[model samples]
Target chain A: MTYTFHWEVPLQNLPLFLWGALATLEISGIAVLLGLLIATCGALARLSKHRLLRGAATVYVEVIRNTPFLVQLFYVYFGLVVVGINLEAFSVAILTLTINCGAYCTEIIRAGIQSIHRGQTEAGLSLGMTQWQVFRYVILMPTLRVVWPPLASQFIATMLGSSVVSQISAEELTYAGMFLESRTFRTFEIFFAIAILYFVMARLFSFLFSLTGQKVFREAWGQL
Target chain B: MRRHGRSWGWIAVLGIVLALAWTASASAAESTLDQVLKRGKLLVGIGLGAPPFGMYDADKKPTGYDVDLAKLIAEELKVEIEWVDTTSVNRIPYLLTNKVDLVIATFGNTPERAKQVAFTKPYSSWNLVLLGWKKDRNIKSYKDLKGKTVAVTRGTTQDIAITKLAPEAKIVRYEDDPVAMLAFEQKKADVMPTAEVLALKKVKENKDMEIKGLVSRSWAAIGVRRGDPDWLQWLNTFMDWHGGQGKFAELFEKWNGVQMPVALPRW
Candidate 1:
């Protein structure tokens, strides 16, 4: 069987696609950052002095982690308007991904937090460090070193997961591919290009994350 | 005294048992009749968000024309109907991976698609309609869309037709029709090419958009994995029976005002 094939950049679509890929990167990046903040808070809550805070964080983690991301995305995009709270699809994409990634980030970070020896914390206390100082320079900083690799991996997963936002028509990489394939009727070719783009984006993210890790943890990189 | 040989004998027996089980499972998978009977439910993969086809009603019940057709198929097989909602991208995967027993989604049969799957006889027709601003007479047809941006959902007949007709018209593809609708509402695109029913429905809701012309004829059929002649014959008989009994006309009147065109062969 002969296949009528025309595979090219479809010049007119390039700028829009470039703009879309940048937006995807922005959404995923901001989400991972905000998600880190949420994870820190959530992980702290899991270790909080207050029972209610711990319960609340546990429930939030369980619910967000268990449900389908697509369902959560729709709930976020449509549920807002249903409650007289409206935001554009881009904002919803960021917000939904932050919540989605934060749940797992909380668990990963919690493990790091728990791994900090009672002896190191005691040493900080003996050195006349304030509770907040001990939590920061001693506990949090060291936990970060322990958790940074897994965190970078989650950030990668978040980038891939953000592709779900295209369902609400949030014009990311996958969304752009959908548009392109539909136009060209080159589903195989267009989707093939998109798969490569995703693979490249994933690799690029890992490379950058490694560079950032080197900058953030110079001593750790030296040991490596 | 012979412990090593005894262990080896047991391992050889385990291997033979596993091989027999694997063959049994392979043969069992193809007996779809037994599957349907055993399950007592026919699981169909469909997109429940699309209107006039597979869609959810206000009550959250799956109740579009395709939903009814899926129900009919289940009833014919003497099984209860279970609907699984999937997106356009996941539909083919759902069928190929055996996630669902069948699919009644509004699958547009294309030469490429025919390679991966078999299609039952066409049960419904879905043609493309050009929707423009209600008052725009200047952009009536493909000839007029030159240098204009037209928005359409990805993986649809409208997308193919627009590109085929007006290569000069810059096509902006959206993942869903609603996004294209928003683009049309915002005047980002000169027109939105979509299935006729959707165009008419969107035009009605907006009351400010108008459908210009029917662009191309298409047959939307229930899709199954390729090399299923047994399944295909069964589905064809079912479709032909229902199509002749005027179920489609009833479905059309039921699903708003998109009538089944008389020119299209029903059975």
Candidate 2:
């Protein structure tokens, strides 16, 4: 109650916070892109006819989903050095984010793939489409339509969870907040500003995802 | 339009309620000294993460230099001690928010922090030094840290100092002392600026690392909320009394395994 609010602190450090926001977006953007690629491949592998491929994807999803993100981040940043794989903190952050979110995305995509009836594949084959063509035309598109909402949520979660990368000094929004808070000691004001910034960024991300979904599934956009 | 007006009315009501609550709390608030005496407890904040200064022992009890110092102060005040675990970044905020009556968590006295909290006379002192591998003989001064990744605990004195002194250096800040030290140990950083005692401990563990350069001599003091002149004066008197009696020196030697300085700067 004796505390005096320093509202000017966040305003004065607005540039740094913006820079941090940019870094947060950069990492989250790259991680989401790479995670999508990994998830698509992992989902396909999980449903592959070959035993080894399915087992590998299953193990990856199980292991990553079971472990905490912080421990995985520490391992990627610190533990990987022992094996002679030295990467910068930013790279380690992106790598860990991609790997961690890839697991969740893989499960999500897998569920979407499974939701497709076997009759759909049979219908595609009866129309004389190749296996790859059937997968591309008959399965993947509808699966994406079915899963876009949850997928968008997961992507947002990944973006928000990117805040944890500040632990490794990745210079993201949360790190900028910590840096400013350290110097100014205006904890409430700084964090209040940071929370608003993060909320704005997350909303921006959600908007972008919705736009992309609308464009990619133009006819089904309304249903989505 | 009706919904908007209703929301505006709600906002007004909420603001008035908050104002009443603030005034109620403000009126209920008393000076830290009076509050402690009246409550029969001294709420002391200490960083349990920093070792030798504050850390859990083998038995999982909080036993360190800062914890011991807090105990001494509580004993002197004839009150039961209650500890609030703090981190480097939260120390000032904790004091400001009245989460703890005082912080004894190896808090470095600096003008910037002094704006937010009152620091007592020095209870312990150490030089902030650049620590790196002994083989890295090229780093002798602040300029030599250019392009090198220096690890630091976020919000610690060394973090501020290194960032200010060697702005070009790639400073990687961890959340706390132990993690920063871990980053340094794991070779995630090329160098680290830390307290001399902590640097010495690291060097003892790994003979390859040594103190490369002294940045500044830092004094750790008890941090109380600002505007509590009476509380500050009482704590300063307690410091002077114990300091004259060599209680601080005794504790310093016991914890740090080095003789205390013959004279510490007083303000």
Off by over 4 Å in 1: A1-158, A168-172, A176-206, A212-224, B1-34, B135-137, B146-149, B168-190, B254-258
Residues A105-137, candidate 2: write the lDDT tens digits. Answer: 999999999999999899989989999988887
- CAPRI tier for the interface of model 2: medium
For model 2, what is the alpha-carbon lDDT of residue B257?
Answer: 90
Q: Which stretches of candidate 2 lie over 4 Å from their true place?
A: A219-224, B1-28
lDDT of 1 by residue, B4-69 (tens): 579758866865675455334323336455577788988899888678787777898998888888
Candidate 1 docks with a DockQ of 0.17
TM-score of 2: 0.93
Clash number by candidate, in order? 0, 0
Q: How good is the docking of model 1, by CAPRI class? A: incorrect
lDDT of all the models against the reference?
A: 0.77, 0.86
Candidate 2 clashing pairs, residues 3+ apart or interchain = none
Candidate 2 lDDT tens digits, B1-267 = 798689758866865675456435433356788889989999989999877889998998899899999998888889999889999978887777667899999899899998878889989888888899888888876679889999999889998888989988998888888788888888889898888888888889888988887887788999987777888998998888888887887898899898754357543
TM-scores, all models, native as reference: 0.62, 0.93
True contacts kept of 2: 0.58
